[model samples]
Target: MQETGSADPFSLSGVIPPTITAFDEDEAVDYDRTAAHARYVVDGGAHGVFPLGTNGEFPLLSGEERDGVVEAVVEEIDDVPVIAGVGAPSTHQTVRHAEHAESVGADGIVVVTPYYYPLDHDAALEHYRTVAESVDLPLYVYHIPSKTGNALSLDTLDALADIENLVGVKDSSKDVPWLAQAIDAHPDLTFLAGSDSLLFPGLEIGCSGMVSAVANVFPELVVDLFEAYEEGDEDRARDLQSEVYDVRDAIKYGSYMAGVKSALPHAGFDAGPLRSPLRLMDEEDEEAMVADLEALDLL
Candidate 1:
């Protein structure tokens, strides 16, 4: 594991899959299915398992459900760290989530910027500082402005990297130059590109890993891609990276999150249904995705 210092034991490096949280027909959290999928990814060679991120429908879950999901994941997996998502709209809630994650045995916590209400640089800085102080666990800031509507300037990110116990960030901003800037500025901090489409480009610069939604369908694909890139197999890395984009493109043809949820069952996981307001792919589109998976020999 790569460490920033003696205080940092958990490395947020390698192809970490932000796994899906399964639900039953009633939309309740299905812990067994969720844990099974977590184990599946680990057995498929994921460096770590990230549950309840955007792809896991974190915003859709209640705090209690979040607790249960993290607990299930930790108990079910073997040998890899579990970085649980503790993103909330408020700092207090985020702190609570982080505390609960630690209490339930999560190896680390990922805190996305507070959503809905945009904050100035100072407020955002204080927000992370407060949460970091509340927990002893290693923390990774999740910088995904598209969903959270709060972007972290390079200065803000540098400041966060300086915070005690805040070790790294997963940049979903999809801005390669900006991510490159963060990597260059904080050489001690780990930077993970949050999109599969940018995986090759990010690695070409200095990203240590990825937090990919598409990894839900093929954990091995992302793992292989990361391995190929790390081993200096440029041709294999490029080919695998291209394959990731193909699957990601298929998933995005439908609702971004829903497309992933829909693919789980086809991939042999029991992902019940997409939570409300997130519709499933239409029959035709579903067939197309299945076809895409078939073409990739993923099914």
Candidate 2:
């Protein structure tokens, strides 16, 4: 299979973590902590660092805030590709964000489907097509239906695979069969699993790699699983895959990004609170995370 990013040295393969955006007490963007977190994950073994994704709280950030986060991570990400999240409600916004990400030296951009208003297949196709055309960098289709309410059918994905700039996709839909089918159908397209739960099954189904949120807490483990799978060590891959789900469940404790952000403090990185409207973890939640980490021996 001609994996989407195979031609480029900065291929979007292996364990890529959508890094959390740290904030200060006043909920202001903390570039220093954000950059440190990026460095932490890369040093921990992430092949790529994604900023301003769902875990990074993109929808809640302002123009300056999001751009700062992207630039900060780009500065710290030395060799690994900084695939910045530039999804927005409109094509205009998405295009501008993609342009800005490119301006700040992001290796590529991941654009989610237009949310808030449901679009039919043709509308969705046109939207993605326009964004890919507007930017010079490689674009990845973020097929996360649960949040966006816009799931691309396998047929739509088939069409997208032909686009010159549409290089890869991250499947968060949780449909293993669909992901496998997409991978088989578009042998050249880069198929990346979106959640930690899909890590093992996705690779089994021929996915090139994954964009795991839990990789924030344990990058080495995620990288180990990918290496095991690539080396044909199914048993070791299964073991690491199981460990990742435990980490994923632990971080999914509080509301939205709170779990991951809260869990980072124990790993020696104090990822600040979630943005407004997204509540922080309470003391009880903290205790649960502590217990979970203790059980996992990650503490």
Error of 1 at 296 (Å): 2.3
Could you tell me the lDDT of residue 136 within candidate 2?
86
lDDT of 2 by residue, 214-271 (tens): 8888888899999998888999999999998788788777787677778888887888
lDDT of 2: 0.85
Q: Runs in model 1 with CA error above 4 Å?
A: 1-8
Q: Candidate 2: worst 10 consecutive residues by lDDT? A: 1-10
> Which regions of candidate 2 fall more than 4 Å away from where they truly are?
1-9
Q: Please, what are the lDDT tens digits per residue for candidate 1 over residues 1-299?
A: 12222334664678888888888898878899999989988888899989989878899888999999999999997599899999999998999899999998999999999999988899999999999999999988899999989999988887777788898888999988898777777768878889888988888887878888888778889999889988889899999989998898777757656688778779877688878877678788888988988898889
Query: What's the distance in Å from true for residue 174, model 2?
Result: 0.4
* Distance from true location, Cα of 237 in model 1, Å: 0.3
RMSD of candidates 1 onward, in order = 1.9, 1.6
